[model samples]
Structure formats: structure tokens, C-alpha cells
Target: MTSLLAILIGCLYAAAIYMMLRRSVVKLVIGLILLSNAANLLIFTAAGLERGVPPLIEEGQQVIAGTAADPLAQALILTAIVIGFGVLAFAVVLIHRACEVVQTDDMNEMKGTD
Candidate 1:
């Protein structure tokens, strides 16, 4: 399962990168979303899959010795998701304003004007 997840994450990352290189603004946004999801999945996979005793420290509570899920990775992924959403939102607004002002989605045309 880990290997399969790794492969899937790799494919997602590749597709995200390919889309990011395209000239379309919408494709870039989609690429950013895909890249963020791929990164989250990679982190999740690295944190181990088998569930064991919870990390909580309390009376009669014991931590597992083997492949336990890491909470830190999960936290990191959550943070990344929030940040990605914020960035994507900003990008969308920026793209919308650019389209309104410049009247074109072609980045090359925008660059030529400068």
C-alpha cells in the first residue's frame, strides 16, 4: 500500500509540474492544487501507515514500539493545505484582476508589453 501510494503521489507530482509549465492561468492554478495534494500525500506516506497505540501520555496508556502513525506529519500536511488554499485564492484574485486590466490570459503578451 505504501509503494502504491508513493507511485500515485509521484504521478500526481509529475502531472502538477507539467500543468504548471503550461501557459494558461487556470492550468497553473490546477497545477498548484495538484502539487499541494501530492506533497500532502507524500508526507502522509512517510509518516507510516500502520496504526498503533495513540501518542497520548496518560495512566495505563502506552506508546507502540513499531510503525506508529506520526502526528507531526499530519499536522504539517494540514498546515500545508491551509497555506496552499490561501495562496491559490490570492492567485485567483490576481489572475482575475490581470484579466480585467490586461484583457488577455497569455503571459507572453503581458511580458511583451513591459
Candidate 2:
């Protein structure tokens, strides 16, 4: 399962880089989204995958009894997701306004702001 996820993450990163290298502004945004997703997956994979175990410890237990999910990783991923969403929204709005003003979605054409 982890090997599969690793392969998937690598593909995502490749796609993200490809998109980011494109001249289209929309593709750049898509790439950014893909990059963020890949990063999240990387974090998840690094934290390791556990089965049938809760992330929290028992009320009376000083520590978890056995192998359990890392709560910190989960929280980090959640926070990253929220931040990614905000970045996506901001990028979309910025792209929209740029397109409206510049009358083009080509990054090359947008360079003539002067």
C-alpha cells in the first residue's frame, strides 16, 4: 500500500512540475494545487500508516498501548489542507483579475505591466 502511495505521490509531483512549467496562468494554478496535494500525501506517508488503531491514548494510560496513528501528522495535514484551500482561492481570484486587466492568460503577455 505504501509503495503504491509512493508511486502515486511521485506521479503527482511530476505532473505538478510539468503544469507549473507551462506558459498558461491557469496551468500554474493547477500545478500549485497538485503540488500542495502531493506535499500532503508526502506528509501522510512519512508519518506511516497504521491499521485499526486510534490516534489518541486511553484516558488513564500515560501513553498509547500499541502502534497508533500520529495525531501530530493528522493535525499538520488538516492545517495544510486549510492553508492550501486559502492559497487556491487567492490564486484564483488573482488570476481572474489579472486576466480581466491584461486580457490574456498567458504568463509571457502578462509581463508587460508597464
Number of the top-ranking candidate, with TM-score as the measure? 2
lDDT on C-alpha atoms for all candidate structures: 0.87, 0.94
Task: Give lDDT for model 1.
Answer: 0.87
**Candidate 2 regions with alpha-carbon error over 4 angstroms:** none
Q: How many backbone clashes does candidate 2 have?
A: 0
Any runs in candidate 1 off by more than 4 Å, and if so which? Answer: 60-68
* Cand. 2 Cα-lDDT: 0.94
TM-score of each: 0.88, 0.93
Kindly give the number of clashing pairs for every candidate: 0, 0
lDDT of 1 by residue, 1-114 (tens): 999998999999999999999888878889999999999999889888877665666667575455555789979999999998999899999998987887888777766764
What is residue 79's positional error in candidate 1, in angstroms? 0.8
